[model samples]
Target: MSDIDLDSARPIFIAECRELLASMESALLRLPQEADKDRRDSVHGIFRAAHTIKGSAGIFGMEDIVSFAHAMESVLDHVRDGVLPIGDDLIALLLACADHLGQLVDSVAENQAQPDAELVHDARPLLAQLNQRLLAVRMQRSPGAGDAPQRKAPAAPRQTGADHWHISLRFGRDVLRFGMDPLSFLNYLQRLGRITTLVTLHGDVPLLDGLDPEACYLGFEVALESSAPLSAIEGTFKFVMDDCEVGILPPGSPVADHLTLMRERARGDPAELQRLRAIWLHCASVAPEALDEIAAAATKPAPAQPVPAPAAQPAAAPAPAPATVRARRTGPRPGEASTVRVDADKLDRLVDLVGELITASASATMAGRGLRSAALQEAHEALALLVQEVRDSALQLRMVKIGATFNRFHRVVYDAARDLGKDIALEISGEDTELDKSLVEKIADPLTHLVRNAMDHGIEPPALRLAAGKPAQGTIRLNAYHHSGSIVIEISDDGAGLSRERIIGRARSQRLLDPGREPSEAEVFALIFEPGFSTADAITSLSGRGVGMDVVKRNITALRGSVSLASRSGQGTTVTVRLPLTLAIINCFLIGVGGSVFVLPMDVVEECIDFIDPGANDYTELRGQVLPFIRLRRLFGVQDTPPRRQSLVVVGHGSQRFGLVVDRLLGETQTVIKPLARLFAHLRGISGSSILGSGEVALILDVAALADITRAAMVSRSPAAAAAEPVHQG
Candidate 1:
């Protein structure tokens, strides 16, 4: 214990604090939705979270966290015990406290031991509210419990000694080496209760030659008179338990407890044993038989073995799993297996190394393609399979369920609804869907904006909703699922949907639309994503001035993803976002456009067809449908004539389909996505570059962006040009 690196433990402490805070928030939110037993359970859960945080913070000597969380814990304890009812105001206050705690925990991560001045100011009023509630409840209960004149009396008035608690503390020899002060814990003990008796012992002190100045060799016995709960009394010494031995006896403990104390302090010294016995005897009277038994045990010549200390408390409990729509068993059963939490950066390094292994494996397979030996080919094939498995396992480490991320919105909806004075309920589904952890983090802000926008603009006011024959309480849905090897997230609201006339009117005013041309509904909806595009008639804190939605689109686009909007006037609106499962690697269909090779995400590639000459028309008929095509050779500015034999690779992104004309189809391959250099970041229709096994570079085409570009080009082309090839549909 003395050699433990306490500083190293800080990171783990901060992480645990974050998880506890999240649980506290969840429990608080549930309180309003639940009732009876469920509500009571929620209150208990909240109490446990606050108590654990306070105790753990004490161990780390984070006084700010300890004090703030202690105040919250007191309020929660009263709520759980039915001294105070759990009401809307109390729930809101607890949520604020949880938020403050989260900020404090983050401060710890920032290497600030104490919370900042602003946090202190915010917390002071919250703490006052909690303490005031506690005092009010106590005052209300006092008259009922203390002034009931007709209540039945006990057998006799309780004795003073019977109401006091006895505490036994023995300092470890190396307590000081652990950076803990034994006296500090004793000082904190007085804050919980009045101390009636205190006696210190130095029996463990060594001879001068053997003594070490840094080592602690002290112990104390104390009698405390108070009405605090046992858990609270035990928590006072939580920080020093690792460096000392502690035993707590409740009021009116048995004579055997005092006898055991005598033997522990004796150390074969009769005078020292008698002093301990006298201390206990003076604090409380004992029966003659009990005294004789204690005397007999103390008189026996005990072996010279040293007394053992009580077991220290366990570290804080691991956080509960994220609240899910359904419950399932998690983690391993006894005797099965266990897990260790690794630093995220280390896991990322491992994933990078695995990616390199994948590239190297592809290189080997390329080298072996020329080998005639069947055995060598078989070996290379087997190696490829193993490498693929390893890559998959490594990637899985970064795939976390989106449920935790989704759960965060509960609080967001709760707070935003209150601020806007709207009755909005957020319904979430498919939360168990998993995505790359990095994507989960980067997507949070964009999702936040979408959620807020939906609550503010998408959901109509309660009165309007009711007048429109809808429920007074509006509903906003966040749903996620995997489609075509990509994750699709939809934020939809049951409110007055986008007004096409208003949007087109606004677009024309902003010159986002052609002067005298009317665009289709799809094209009109797409204009909302353009910068500074909004149909809001007024400005407010949440929306207005055309901001949030455009940013959401940009951020999603930056991730090589796509966003689209669909709405029906007076019905509802849904914003759909599509993103790849992982950014590190993907399966790609390789193709050759003139002298260069290109990769198209395999999930989006529908099929390849012969590139028949459509005679001055870029659009061709495929399966009885007029399909627009973008010639890669021309789009990439490749200085080469079209190949005699070419193929069009038809790809589908979301609801749109388009073709890429290339010299030949190169089939499928595992593509390790290497990001484009900063210099090429602004390049259009190309997301990233990849190194092939043959040491060639292949650019990974952005299918979604290319589809958009093809549609835009068709929209801009002259009517005669687009109609050069007859439009057909099955």
Candidate 2:
């Protein structure tokens, strides 16, 4: 039974451990800038993560994880106690320890009874470093044991006269059956402080015939003398809080606190009330009158009605038990929604169902449009609204903050900076921007490549940056935000920006540049994404291969996204990646070109305007600006004569603008984007196909790709032809 329980809980434990590792890394990364109070909080948080993982690992009997985490927790403990000062060296060592612990957890996840020998061998040096620091702490405390004592300021003394914390614990009957030893918690508590006094109660023990060997029926009243904070003591029993009833009274707590604990503990048993009073009188400095009042209240018949909740306090006292403290840690104090840990597969299944619901709703709406009855149309309209709401909610389930992905680059920048002997600082902004989870995962590798490339090739050495009147430390900024119904991620660096001369040189050498005509600045910048294109003067491990940039463009395009590069010679370089919010389903403007239907993602559709001439010219004047337009019929090689009354669908892709001339506007649609099969994946200006309510296939137009095609066409035309009034023969 124990084995079965452990197996059932292993996955949850692993998931929590991974979260703890991420949080630990984040705290360590921010340690350098934290203030004194913030630093203490950060250290304590790091300790809790390690301690929780250690305790949970011990429960699963993963000794490799427990042993290493125990050591890491010890070092964090010393740091928390102010015995060890935090520094870059210490933080580095701790980060390394975190990595090793992650490896141990991964080993367990791989079904290994023990960690790999190579990993264990690597951990030895880190363990030694940790223990050496711990040993130094102990020696420093011992009188006359070291040459010079380098000690931190003394911790604040306990506030009141009392010095012993009062702890009350009642082990649940299932504790023993759950493989938890009551005495083990006692031993762990000792690590925080000395237990000055203990009173064990066995009143709950059953008769001989009723006793169960595996059941636990013990309680303890302990007086612990220590300077540890209330949070630290509460953390001792955090794992078992749900399984057992636990209460803690801080040193010098008010008599009211003890009274509260007694009332809670003595709910039904009169003997239990007397026993608790006896223990409280022995451990606390409360007067006999307070105990008499509590005893008197315990004996009085409880009110027949349930007690009302206490009113809110302007300045409430801290909670004493681990359970209460854990609640406060988990969520906000008020109006917080209860959350459950749902499996990702479950959420994905819900999204798939929602997609189907949207499709069906569209079909019903289409059917209703053909009906002559207004009542039927109204009903269908209501249903459509409900389905749209459901779809939004479903998509939101898969929208995750990009903070995790952004923070991951901290380590990348750190390692790359060290490897290149450069001083680079990463500044992350808009981390809370939410996007589709699938796009987040797919964009990670490409973003990583771009970030490293910027650091390696775009950013100059620190000396050069200083000479350029910039700060000694180069800065790389990662910014994300929502723009026009899409998520835009920008990776910008305050470094020596892209060199136009060098880029053009490389493009010319690669035969990517047309010698007959000069390219626009945008065209020159776009050359960087050409396959096998690079401007690096020499081959280096990071960037000279020229493979990553082109691949980045391709991958982003695969997601129906676009990547644009902007740079100035001496200012900086910024690579902007624009991606759809969700690829599963979209609201599109369906248009017809010849006999084929096309869907333009509504988010990019600026407006639809009357087309004065279908084929008289390739550019149109919209307001005062020359809007370059692409003829869909010509672009797709439609053999049919163009419709006499065509319409232009104005679309914007980042800063570039273009128009698409269509045969007819089919109005708005709810579309589920279906990826093209491999045989047709190479089709230009089309991302995927969608099935409309009429059972016709509509090619979902790639606005970014079409904008690119427009730009390319403009570049191929003569200057006069590219002008606003140029005439072209079909």
Of the candidates shown, which would achieve the greatest lDDT relative to the real structure?
A: 2
CA displacement after TM-score superposition, residue 197 of candidate 2 (Å): 3.9
Question: TM-score of every model?
Answer: 0.76, 0.85
How well is each residue in 458-536 modelled by candidate 1, as lDDT tens digits?
A: 8988899889999999998999999888999999998899999888889999999888888977799999888999877
Of candidate 1, the 10-residue stretch with the lowest lDDT total is: 319-328
Taking the tens digit of each residue's C-alpha lDDT, what string does model 2 give over 553-659? 99999999999999998889999999999989898899998899999889889899998873566776777677788888988999988867989888887777888
lDDT of each: 0.78, 0.80
Weakest 10 consecutive residues of candidate 2 by summed lDDT: 151-160
Q: Which candidate is the best by TM-score?
A: 2
Off by over 4 Å in 2: 110-122, 135-165, 171-218, 224-260, 263-274, 287-335, 368-374, 514-517, 538-541, 614-616, 720-730
